[model samples]
Target chain A: MFSSMTISQLRTLLRAREVSAEEVVISVFDQIDKVEGDIEAYVTLCRSEALVQAKRADALLKEGNAPDLCGIPIAIKDNISTAGLKTTCASRILDDYVPPFDATVVTKLKEAGVVIVGKTNLDEFALGSSTENSQFHVTRNPWDRSRVPGGSSGGSAAAVAAGEAIAALGSDTGGSIRQPAAFCGIVGLKPTYGLVSRYGLIPAAPSLDHVGPLTRDVRDAALVLQAIAGWDGKDPTSVQKELPNYEAVLSEDITGLVVGLPKELLDNELDPEAKEAIFGVANVLESLGARVEAISLPHAEYAMASFYLIASAEISSSLACFDGVRLGKRYGEAKDTTSMFMKTRGQLGIEAKRRILVGTAILQEDNYTTYFVKAQKVRTKIREDFQQAFGRCDVILSPTTPTPAFTLGHKLDRPVIMYKSDVYTSLANLAGIPALSVPCGYTEGGLPLGMQIMGKPFDEATVLKVGHLYEQQTASERRLPQKEVKANG
Target chain B: MELSLKEMEELALIARLYLTEEEKKILPQQISSILDMVHSLETVDTEDVEPTIYPITGSGVLREDEILPSLAVKDALANGPDIVDGYFRVPRIIEEEYES
Candidate 1:
């Protein structure tokens, strides 16, 4: 029950002296110990340190000096650095590597007295849409063990869904967080690109990457976002723009709010069930005094193409640091300089290699003008498309992914199909806007379906507010995968 | 957009990755498929559009170049596969070239 409780609920319970932080943390770990074998949600559990931190949080709570996240147990994506902890990014290359410093988000979480339960699994360097690409074990969807929790934030999403962690932090680039949140029945937010600092987050694609929270509900997402959302001197791309108190905007009236449903994103290719769920969200918003209308983002169809080119290009440049000379595991005996670099770098997983090679090819002297530069121009067009769409509405709505959670290994063999999974969700990342995926409804088969709410750049407050309102108005839509489902699977 | 074996090998080298013969044989196809998917971008016309290199709108912050406390040598070398005298130890490439 403690594991199922939201951050807001847990905070009240902690304040009432009804539960100690240690109890909540123990409860979470117990749930993890019970379910992790089946879910494979975590890459490494920080059990000892978490308990130690929980005890300290209890003391702070008692002294009335606690922050909102005091005593809450949260899982971080493996890619985010945790001081002295193995932040492997779910890749074998960094299997034994530990950071000497915590990521900016981790430091903020520590300052807020949150106990970090563990680092959750991810696609190798967050490269894929499913956790199947991880070098470790694949993480199963909590709803059905046979299926995947959509990734590269799959492990973080699954952990929160299964009550393994109260909430988890996940980074999104091309739908990593939102798609997983949709598949797992939770709220996952991709804050505006510059809203959260990227100080120590392992780069998947620097320009597109965003750090956000996956929570049981919108309020918990807001709490976690508040703690970690701010500019830092360490990340130059981080914006100095003031962030509105997300919690304050959640309950604001939506009488005049305009919700745009992008017509292009709702192609007939979408699963009928997902389309119905998304439209159902619009109806709910309409009943709540919000105006909903169809809008167009014509360039939405080109989002995937541009995203792959741009993201891979950035990845190729960012990952050039891992030559095994300074860090990471070396693959073979080094006989010479070229051999040493080549052998060690070859330790990257197949997906990582695929992206790197494609990225390398795109940036090649003969191809740069045709591929890299062209994609950047299309990137500008995509951003402009969203900017124009925003002129007619407060936020845009669409299905987070084409469908609900797919069976694990379904799209692994076909790289293109796997990339298509993020089609509906990647547009926001390309446009550098804020987006949130909230549980809109469920399939008749009982799998979760997600509705994406996207807003203009640096407009996370609006996005969260809209998601929170829809969540509040459509409480019946929220359904958890039965515990017995996992037990039976 | 089709990458030949030679091109794949060249790319692996650029990426500083050594591939087995089997990887080299298969990589051309794998990389080609991904490139074909991304080729859709070439269809879009953006003759007048300026490329967006950085999504975040702001110039880099200027800071005084001041000395600061940094990672300890031991911690820096903690994960290095081979270390010698607090420095990462790699194969003697220069020596090997000279000998060859």
Candidate 2:
């Protein structure tokens, strides 16, 4: 039960001395022992290290006046570096590569006194939509083991949903965080680009990458965001802006708030169940005194294509450092530098290689203007679309994903189908706005459906507030996937 | 646009990935389809629009010239596959020419 508690709930008990940090950690680890074999959410578990941190947190609690997250156990996606821990990014190339220093967010989390449980699995270099692309193993949907937990942050979302961790950090590049969080039936927030420092996140796409929180509820997301959202000199792209207190906005009313439902997103090939769930959210918002209206993002249809081109182009350049020279595993023997480069780079997984190859071709002089530059121009249009829509409404609402979690390996062979899963979610990344996925309802099959609330740049306060309001109204829909997991097992 | 096997091989070479025979057989079709998907970007009229390389609006940050303690050589070389004198060891870059 302690493992299943939210951060706010655990904080009360921890501050009151009713439950020690060590007890919470042990309970979480116990749950891990119960279902990790079937769920496969984590790539690495630091039980001894977590226990050590928990014991430290208990000591701090004895001193009184500790941080809100003090003693909370949280998971970090494998792509984010943790000092003295292996940060594999779920790729074999970096299996034994332990970081000598922590990522900027990891450093911030440590300062807040949260015990890091472990590194969760992800797609190789965070390249794919499903954890099946993970070099380690597939992370199954806790709601249905036969399905994926959505990725490349699948493990983080799954861990939080199944009570393996109270909350977790996941990086979003083209819905890596939101999609998985939606699939796993939890709240996931992708902060405005440059809001969180990306100094240590293994980059999938630098321009599009954002590090954010995936938690059991919207309040927990705000708490984690409070700890990690800031600028760092190490990350030049990080914006120097004063962050609003995200937790303060949670109780605010949405009486006159205008929520926009993009006509373009709804007109796409959406599942009937997902469409129904999206409309159901509109009704709920309207009942809360918020006005919902249909808005158009004319260039929205081109987001997916532009995102893939931009992301792949950036990924090709970003991953060039793994040439087996400075770090990471090098492949077979070679006589010369060219052959060595080729052999060492051959360690990339199929999807990674595919993206890199496509990226390479896109960046070629002949195709540069046709693909890469065109995608960037289209990206400008996408951002303009969001800007125009936001002028008419405070926030936009849409399905976090087109549908709930699909069966594993269903779209594995079809790259385009897998890419299509990100269509609705990637628009936020392309526009560099904040988007949060809160569980709105569930399908008849019992899988969760998520509705995304997107806000203007650096307006995370409004986004979190909207999500928190919806979450409070729909509290009954919040259920752990444990029973479903156990039944499937 | 469909790519030929030769084109796929060229891309693999540029990416520095060594594709196997089977990958060579399947990748061309896969890459071509992905290309076809992305080609939709061309349909949008972007004649005069400026490209967005970075999403944020501000100019790049420039720090003052200052000496800062950085990663230790031992720590930097800790994860290297092969190291010599605290430097990464790699295959020979310059090839030796021989008289025929």
Candidate 3:
């Protein structure tokens, strides 16, 4: 039912009585039922609860109580705490854990009348590049079931692409949302850090973590972001600022907008298909009258190393609170407390434990001065690099991921190789800039590739404007994931 | 740059996860390789640079202090791993040995 409509289109349909909210929610359920068995996209789907909300939305809209997201259905990445809903970060530790209260973003979305249909699967503790790291089972890509939907936000991307939901909320620690969006051929945005609140979001690397949106189109992404953006006192990182009308920016022309591309960032180690997709988008922009130039952000070369050290260190500390004594899984009915500690965490996936250990090592006093402190300086340099590059251009363009969706087990044996999968997207997180991933084309193997549009700090409007404009120019539009999931009803 | 067996075991204790000797053996190598990869920051110079421990940008976020009622006890305990007599309960702290 939503295979062809954007969020705005769905809102208009609800407003016009062309389709009741129940009908749309029911359609989403129908789609989920048809495809989830084959795709295994969800962790949990609240069919009865979702329908109840849908009926209420229909009633509320009928009574003129509709808000911005009235009747719109979305799936949330399970790591984000959703009150009364199971909010596992796809880790065995929190397999059955239910959050006590809604995260700030969830509260806002509910206030806006957005109905959550389900919680989707993800990499354990939001750690991996592919959904296969999930403790439960892998979420297959909608484009090719044999391949993975790039992850930690893979299931959120899958749910949106498979049409299980209209759009989804995803947390990007190090490119989780953007990589998955690129793999699924959907549009994903990693907003400037602090643009969205993190209170109630279970921390992975809290400082690096950002809540963002994944949608089938750019305008829908913008609509979703508008509702979720803004400061919340509940989130320590939330910023206070006036909210902008995101929808108003879709028509802002990008003609003559200086778009810079530093070849130093590209032209090396990227897959040919990925290169073609990026350059193709540049050609489109050039024809659209945007002046595209190449410049160098010299400090950019050292970013991947800096990103890993910082992210891993924080992951180690933030996850320390998950001892079985407080919440989540506790293992070893052993003779002592030390044993209990070992038993519980040993059950954690190798990847999760691996990061925790590495993070702790980096945070050590002996190493902190050499590794942690130095990474911070490198991070400052990386931001400086972007600042210098942005001086000459309004936005920076690149491939979101260097390759299309890889085979599920492609890099499982080599984790470092896998971390590089986030290369193009992580730089923005370091710079605290807004960057978006939009479908540029498909690889010869049929996997979707994405092109990234990065904006100056706190300037998400420009990213959306360029993405929506590019979307409007293309005749080809998003197709629902090949599999169809229908409600059990 | 990876974790040693001792380090992995230490981390397991801190994280409250148990690991067998075999896992301890396997994890050290696995963790070390990745650590070496992320440790590329050793090449950087951060002297005199302020460390960035947080991502939020801009000025004072200090909020006015005010007393507020807390959530009901039941609500607070809603997600606890285990409970007894309306309170979160855990095994007696093993202070005899391996005390932090």
User: Against the true structure, whose DockQ is highest?
Assistant: 2
lDDT of 3 by residue, A126-197 (tens): 888898899999998888877899999999998888888899999898899999999998999999888898
The residue-by-residue lDDT of candidate 1 on B27-53, one tens digit each, is 788778888887778778898899988
| Candidate 3 runs further than 4 Å off | A477-489, B2-7, B10-16, B94-100
Best by TM-score: 2
lDDT of 1 by residue, A336-439 (tens): 87887888878788888888988998898999989889988998998888888889999999999998999988988788888989998888888888889999
The candidates, ranked best first by DockQ, are 2, 1, 3
Cα deviation at A205, candidate 1, in Å, is 1.0
For model 1, the stretches where C-alpha displacement exceeds 4 angstroms are A482-489, B63-67, B96-100
Q: Global CA lDDT of candidate 3, please?
A: 0.83
C-alpha lDDT of residue A157 in model 1: 96
DockQ list for all candidates: 0.70, 0.76, 0.52
Residue-wise lDDT of candidate 2 within A39-86, one digit each (tens)? 999999999999999999999999997877999999999999998999
Q: Where in model 2 is the C-alpha error above 4 Å?
A: B97-100
TM-score of chain A of each: 0.98, 0.99, 0.97
Q: Residue A160: error of model 3 in Å?
A: 0.7
